[model samples]
Target: MFTGLIDKLKGKRTAAVKTPEIMGLRLGASFELDPLAIRLILDELTIESCSPTQIIRAAGLVELDGTWVYRFYTDDDAWLQVVAEGGQTDEHVVDVKLFHFYDTLDVAGQQAWDRLLQREIGAASYSLRERTYGRVWTSAGDYHNPVHMAEKTYDGDGEHSLTDQFTMLFERPLSDQRTESLFLSAEEKQEQAGYLSRSLVISTGITLTPSQLTIHG
Candidate 1:
């Protein structure tokens, strides 16, 4: 079944991507790609068209666990990760980790994470906190730390839904502020800001597509 997904993808001719090298699955070699490339592969595999059941039922979960546990970063320094465990389908559980670049876990925060794991906090709940350096302020003139928050969770291994886990890891809320931040130039940022300011948050792919969103200027 795992080989079938690879064969299907390999059979499709994507001009620039060179599907055979996606993981060298043809040879039964383990993942040898870097974090970004792996993230891109996961992003493609977990799409709506791909059956999550097939993925979970196959050896894919083992690959995901063995290879993807390390942190993966975005261009802006934000990072995310996923780890799967258990041998049986019903026993399978996945842990997702996301970290915004600005938020660094302190010694106490690290201990808290360790305790959270020790206690096996359930999936329905999470802990979030703002990091600060005393009364330090940023050059942006907003609150010193601003209202930005990083999201990283450590949940206990147990019975879980892989589909639900996929959604949580891939889909993200879209808003004007986030759209505005995407712009690199001042003019572009100002242009998108007006449009995003009038829009409401919606669940959409982080890449931004017109199909799932309609922002007004």
Candidate 2:
């Protein structure tokens, strides 16, 4: 009777483990690692011979239906999104929406931006060409409508446009100096992008989190 019961339990355990099919993936906010020691619950271990278990919560990775999803983190804050591929990978190619300037700009400034976009005025704006591969922050082409508590399907005013989303940050400065050219042989120019990327993270108060990677198959 004990042998028969053990066979049934093994069958159940095998059925519980399944491979996942991922159509797409989204990463959530990151949390610090919390290592906790708890009781052993594996079938091989009894309380008398159990080993401690530690819970590490780093690089917010969640498994849905056995599929693993990981969060993107920088120095300041975890990329805030319910579903995301990650944040920008290339600093040179940035999405306009990532700029804090747009959200905080005054009405007059917004109008000025509109005019500049319309070619009515001349001004420098953050722009970069669209890239196929990278984090979610790389693509700001779609405008997310805010949820309205009062009503459903209410899209207020004008939708955020991505037509003018890409531009060089230091266009003029870079052009004036060969040191800034992407094709330039200078190693310094190659490193310049990295420096700027980190500086942007620092200026934005994104406390860089330590890298965390967890894989479960």
Candidate 3:
């Protein structure tokens, strides 16, 4: 089910992208690649696609835990991750950590990637926000954030069976986080601003250093 979705992309893939590594699964997952590359495995596989937040919630609810997991993408400053593996009919995506590893728990350099992300996907979609939590998520274990689904399509006659598309989930960005101070010294303000950062759900392969996201234009 290669949609050329990631292939035709120059960074902004989806969820601000990820918000994915879009790897090509092969025998490497079967024989050569480290077994640690695998993330979650589906048995009944009831869903076509889903988000990382959903998976994290399910794990907490069912008490399923793992140290061998990782995030592939996000839209808003790498804060929210969107995962939906429904299109792959060949069913070969295993140990996807090849794209990355579990690093969303840290929020160091969380800022401004979604801007680049939203640009690639034109404005031709619909969005739904979380009923509560006036704020959005910036990582894997935060509140469920809003989503902008792309590629709207219809079924049959195109009037009665219309359904919103979810192939790509684009998360909406919230206002920036900055220090509010008019009475503080310039140095103090600058230092405070340094603490301000977007939510981060991914990081370098295995380092405290935040993953440096590549931005275009």
Candidate 4:
């Protein structure tokens, strides 16, 4: 899939597979393309590939086991297609499967399979934090570090003063929707951001919504 410059430069391709249960399919060698490119391609595909009878509802990338995958859904939020990287051959055919139910496994077997999948997929969540401290004043006008305040003060007035308190909130909401890959890498993030920005500019005459954002991603 990555062999050709035109194909690689084009980045990814998504198609709707005609099947009973599955409504869509996406194909790509990497989620390494600019996000704007992904969004633009998706927008085009949404209109071009969908039929009057079947509406393209949602589409985006997914990451499983460190590899990026592509996904598409229908208006009913039904699984349409799930394609993984490294599965395409020289013919450019994707190793995608129409949505199908796996054979029901017994409780013990299901548990084992779940554990194995988790090991490969890593944790389902991530968090990060940082801390720093320096000379600062309290609401009562007392300095946090007297020695530092003294060293930096002149005529009992400090070079730096903390007159107000500030706080920041962080939260990660649980998503009923699925996540594509681990957050796109730093480079990929920049690319995707740029792409979306450009798309918004071009689509200025159109009303954008959360659904548009989903398609953009």
Every candidate's lDDT = 0.25, 0.21, 0.22, 0.25
TM-scores, all candidates, are 0.21, 0.19, 0.16, 0.21
Model 4, 37-104: lDDT tens per residue? Answer: 23443332212222212243344444335334343434432223333345422233233322211122
Superposed on all Cα atoms, the candidates' RMSDs to the truth, in angstroms, are 20.5, 21.2, 21.3, 25.0
Determine the C-alpha RMSD for candidate 3 after optimal superposition of all C-alphas.
21.3
Name every residue pair that clashes in candidate 4.
23-80, 35-191, 35-192, 36-195, 62-180, 63-180, 63-181
Judging by TM-score, tell me the better candidate of 2 and 4.
4
- lDDT string for model 1 (80-133, tens) is 333435432212425433333323222234455434333322222222232111
Which of the numbered candidates is closest to the native, going by highest lDDT? 4
TM-score of 3: 0.16
Candidate 2 deviant stretches above 4 angstroms: 1-27, 31-103, 108-111, 118-217
- Candidate 3 residue lDDT tens string, 93-203: 232211222232222332343432333212333222221111212336332223323222221222111122111222222233211111000010112445433332222
Sort by lDDT, best first: 4, 1, 3, 2
Q: Residue 122 CA error for candidate 4 (Å)?
A: 14
Candidate order, TM-score descending: 1, 4, 2, 3
The predicted structure with the larger TM-score, 1 or 4, is 1
